[model samples]
Target: MLRADPCATILSPRTSLKEALERLDALMNRLVEADQTGAGIDPLRVAGELGQIRQLLAEAPAVVRAKDGQKHFRCEACGTISHGDRQPERCPTCGGRKFFAADIEQPFVESGAG
Candidate 1:
């Protein structure tokens, strides 16, 4: 069996971790179905595919790095949250930077409006 070309399976722009996992699941189902059908299951091929699927599952998250890398800014003075790259130069709530929490928890979904 010819090994899958790494270049052909690159998941930089077209695929994400979630999608990759879904694809892995689909491949697993196919392998199981093929075995049940007595379709001359090639253990070597099955093993190879399982390995490839595992790799895809492991690599899929790299596509969504930015989504998980978001940081939040919290105004310690008034407990206001700002989901931006950096804390505002001045806190709009208390008009001071004496207390700022850029490491506050960030929700995965983008909060459009306050």
Candidate 2:
């Protein structure tokens, strides 16, 4: 029998942007402290933190767009909708190269009414 990785469960796609940022901040602080004190931080731990930081940075854009209600695009090949100011070079879900605007709403106009 294999056991599930706890870190994977904790740091998932559903992890909020604020939480990710907080984690990144904590990691940076740890690195700074280690650097200043000349402490021997575990090489594996540093490597893991670096990987996590990279992952968080990569996902930050999409998270910000989702929270800000920015425009979204749909992948033509896989129909995956991604939120951003512009279409991603490749679809995050399916790695599709083609995309089009997903949400194109006309501005609401009010008629003169008493």
Candidate 3:
């Protein structure tokens, strides 16, 4: 019997962030159900789902920033971040040619509400 991929629905290119979040929520509900009912959910499958959730959360910010058009690039050799629509032919800091799209992290701001 072939096992269905747990992430297949959420990993699709056309899946929206909202849909992914809903799917993850459903998965979490399953985990909670198993815990409460003493169901025999496979440990390995649980671990794999958690791992995938972690990865998706980690990548979500970058994906959102890219979709918003605030594209960035990082130099593989020197860890320098450059902002632009395309990667620099050569990194300004290290003159490295290879570049990977990266996310520009926004600075934190305090609301001053005490």
Instruction: Say which candidate scores most in lDDT.
Output: 3
Expressed as tens digits, the lDDT of each residue in 32-69 for candidate 1 is: 76679775556765566567666665543221223656
Off by over 4 Å in 1: 1-14, 60-114
On the 0 to 100 scale, the lDDT of residue 101 in model 3 is 74
Off by over 4 Å in 2: 1-10, 60-114
Taken over the whole model, the C-alpha lDDT of each candidate is 0.54, 0.63, 0.63
For model 3, which pairs clash? Answer: none
lDDT of 3 at 68: 51
Pairing residues by index, what is the TM-score of model 2? 0.40
Task: Give the TM-score comparing model 1 with the true structure, all chains together.
Answer: 0.34
Q: How do the predictions measure up, each by TM-score?
A: 0.34, 0.40, 0.41
Alpha carbon RMSD to native, model 1 = 16.6
Candidate 3 segments whose C-alpha is farther than 4 A from its true place: 1-10, 62-114
Ranked by TM-score from best down, the candidates are 3, 2, 1
Best by TM-score: 3
Local error of candidate 2 at residue 112 (angstroms): 52
Q: Across residues 1-114, which tens digit of lDDT does each residue of candidate 2 receive?
A: 443222332366666545665566666676677799796567676566567656765664431134466888867665567877777999987688998785635444344677
lDDT order of candidates, top first: 3, 2, 1
* Evaluation by TM-score, superior candidate among 1 and 3: 3
